[model samples]
Target: MSAWLRRGTAATYAATLGVLLLGAPAAAAAPSAPAPTGAAAARKAAAPPASVDARLFLYNEHGQAAVAPGDTVTFVMSTAGYPENVPQHKTVVLELPEGVTFRSATNQHASGPCVPDAAGRKVTCTTQDPVDQLPATNGAWWVTTDFSDELPLGEYVTAKATLTTEIPDPEQDNNVSSWDVFVATTGDMSVAISAPPGPWKVGDKFDATFKVHNFGPYRAPFSLSSGINPVSGLRYSGWPEGCGFDPGEMQCTFGVLEAGKTFEFTMRFEVTEYDADGISLTPTIYPGNQDTNAANDKASYRAKIIKPSASPSPSPTGGQAGGEPTLPITGAPAVPLAAAGLSLLAAGAGALLLARRRRTS
Candidate 1:
């Protein structure tokens, strides 16, 4: 009986250990190693390669921001693109104001000669090529217009330009440019001449100061010429900054004078002869481009230069009725004195000749 009990307890302990082992969870597996990368897997996304752009600007030979009537403005049109075979509409449209007209236009890629034609104030520049090659893409067109005769102070003539391309433009800001050129003339430039102080002496140099005033409305460059009267006996000796003596007139140029502005210039004149009673300087101003009034364009001024008074000669008798007691001429005859002087001059000449001949021999 004791041996049977011991065997049954050992069998129960073995069964419980087997049940515990079966109920426990399984251990986790090892982490996986990554695969090697290739060239195809390393590539990144990129932007589109093909694009075109257009820009417009105004230019001139002298690079001035303002323009007057009959002035030319160069409209520079530039277009460039990468992978350039893109079918695009490259154009520049000029929206001008009233009183402005298109003069001419040229295109390098034009199929035929560019004879610029315009409809009123709208000017158009567009390439006709279906697929425009970017190599011959840049070009310019010249347009001219007449500014108003009179413009208000600080006002400018304006024109709008729109540059475009059919393809996507990387820069959309520069596609639109505008021109604001000032109309350079607004008023009449009136000038006048003033003669120097009068009663000048003959054979003396003098100066004539001129006061030029802008009487009309706008600012303008002026060319002034003073007509020198030949009878005035006043010869042009020198002139101030903008003055020059051209043929019969003393000419000078004043760049730009604004309204209510005054410019002073001095021209020197010398009295060449006596009897210079009514010397005059007639000045005429030719304002730039246009002039409003013809009547007031010129004015006259006069000056005087006279000969000095003559003094009375003293009497040979010293103002006495009876001349001082004088001894009769007791000297040799004038003919004999003259003969003696001639004989002495001949002897000196002979001596000089003898000395030269001896030196030569």
Candidate 2:
């Protein structure tokens, strides 16, 4: 079995609290208070006694909860939510699924030895000691199993585990847990990214579209995982739901995509500071199912960052390059203020001379 297709895991926590009245109410001695009503008394009498809560779960190395044939998997059975200083009648039972052979089991938290049946199909671990030590109510066991190489592809199998106590549990739903494992098949999964064209300048915001395409012979079930790298100069401004993010990386998971189908989403980014001449948004994809093509698994979109250009020095004469010097007019004339004033003064002098000549005539 290939490493990527070998393992997937599912884990969940369960807690059930049974309240016990260890002491009487402060007002119980008050004679003036009325006694309990008929229904209240009947209900109180019918209530069960307090007991320790126990939960069971099966876990694997990876979180996807899947497995492939011929793969050896180690499952961890964990017990939790057992109150302190309580008597423990703890017993854990594990049953193997078809086509899976049990190898071994070990106790981690309890004092009991794990005993497997003659055929290795079932195992039991138990402890009779009361939980005297603080936090001693927990139990954990490691169990190993191997999938027969003859197991067919795309087969879904389930392994069962249960935790039990001598006393009845307040919540029975969590006492047993089942881990679902799937035999994955290869589906050619690939990703492509499209970003707004740049010269992207600082303070500019844009959306990048990511499309995940499954060029398949099989459906990519249980979704897919993608890593969108945040290159220099680009800061994440917005993210779609169903994704997890960290500095410099964004992780997203999409639901099942059928063969030849594509899943599309968008992420908003802003150009904050430029660390290089360009930024490349490269998103790589890993399918929950097996994938054979590595070449098309990732795609990149490159954008050139536009650096701040130096402000042009004030033209020596306050005029733009290759253009004539612009003159400021005092009023409506298209001439310099000084030149217009001089012309007005000369015209006034000529008018005065003409008046003198007319008087002489």
Candidate 3:
């Protein structure tokens, strides 16, 4: 344990520890070194521009028959834009045709430019006043207007409305887009039949009427046919005197009807004596070669014939009055045995009394 030897050992250990710590830091720094070039930053900045497409669509609340000369039709506008950052709401101008008179306009939850004509006949709109502006949330824009009383009938009229979308383009000015709306004239034709209850008794006759209406723009050709419901015991009277089917039989007839006009056909039917139960009286429309769609093709009227409970003849023994006889009576003579025997006894007594008188004399 010499002091000089101990001091030399301590100096050597301290020097070793310092060398180990310095070497450890150099090794760590070599593996964790930062790159001089920023490749990720350059890739993000040089990315390609995104593609954008915008579309607008208009729909009428009423389908095929939505438009009428004096009816109000609603037009709904919607838009779809790509590149999620695009702005949806903007100024919209609706140019209507002479026939379509704008009554009033409104926008729910929108702010900007809106102006209406002095007579409230035409509506000029902007972001501040959208004739029919949709919310900022992309979707439907709707407005309804009534047809002016001056709108003429019997003709198809078309009107147009325009919707403008302001798409924000910070890099460019005047970034407005527009869509078109179409309004069409409306009309329809329909027919219905009204008939009385059937199952009429034999020799009974009845009348029925078929009413046809023009609910649409133009005149339509219609046909009517009347037939007996075999199950109803009812039959159509053969060709009413002045009235006859187009083909000469009462089976079918044709006629022309003008818009808003009503036409009726009266038919008569007779109930036959031999007609069976469950027979029906029916009338049907035969729209032959008509341009009307199948949806309006034909309508039917029906009545049934039920057997009557009373009859002239009494029921045969053990058989129902209305049903065929179970047993039939045959030709046979009737005899009375009690009268024959009484006559025979009288004759015998008279003969015996005569014999007794002769013997007594």
lDDT of 3 by residue, 1-361 (tens): 5999999999999988887879977676676655434643343345333432445454555632324456676654554555543444544444455666565446574234345465544555544322222344434445566766566543344544345555433332222333222223334556666667664667778887667677646654445554445533445653433345432124544444576788776767677654443444345554322334455545665554566677689754786678866766455533456677789999999999999999999
Per-residue lDDT tens digits of candidate 2, residues 1-361?
4644443211111111111232344345446766667644543455434776767787674656456678877767777765533445678888888778777655455446568788777878676344433223456667788888877665567778888877667888899988767766776888888877787888888898888888877666544344433355567756666678666667776556778888888878788876554767767887756778889878878777777778888745567578878785355655576688999999999999999999999
Model 1 Cα shift for residue 221 (angstroms): 2.0
- Distance from true location, Cα of 56 in model 2, Å: 2.4
Q: Best to worst by lDDT, what's the order?
A: 2, 1, 3
**Residue 149 error for model 2, in Å?**
2.5
Full-model lDDT, candidate 2: 0.69
Model 3 bad stretches (over 4 Å): 1-52, 107-114, 117-134, 168-361
C-alpha TM-scores of all predictions:
0.40, 0.62, 0.33
Count of steric clashes across candidates, in order = 5, 4, 23
Model 1 worst lDDT run, 10 consecutive residues: 39-48
Off by over 4 Å in 1: 1-101, 104-186, 231-233, 275-278, 289-295, 304-361
Identify the superior model by TM-score, candidate 1 or candidate 3.
1
How close to the true structure is residue 329 of candidate 1, measured as C-alpha lDDT?
Answer: 57
In candidate 1, what are the lDDT values of residues 103-186, reduced to their tens digit? 655544432222334454776766654333332233344545445445444445667777666667888877777766556644
Candidate 1 TM-score, true structure as reference: 0.40
Flag the better candidate by lDDT, 1 or 2.
Answer: 2
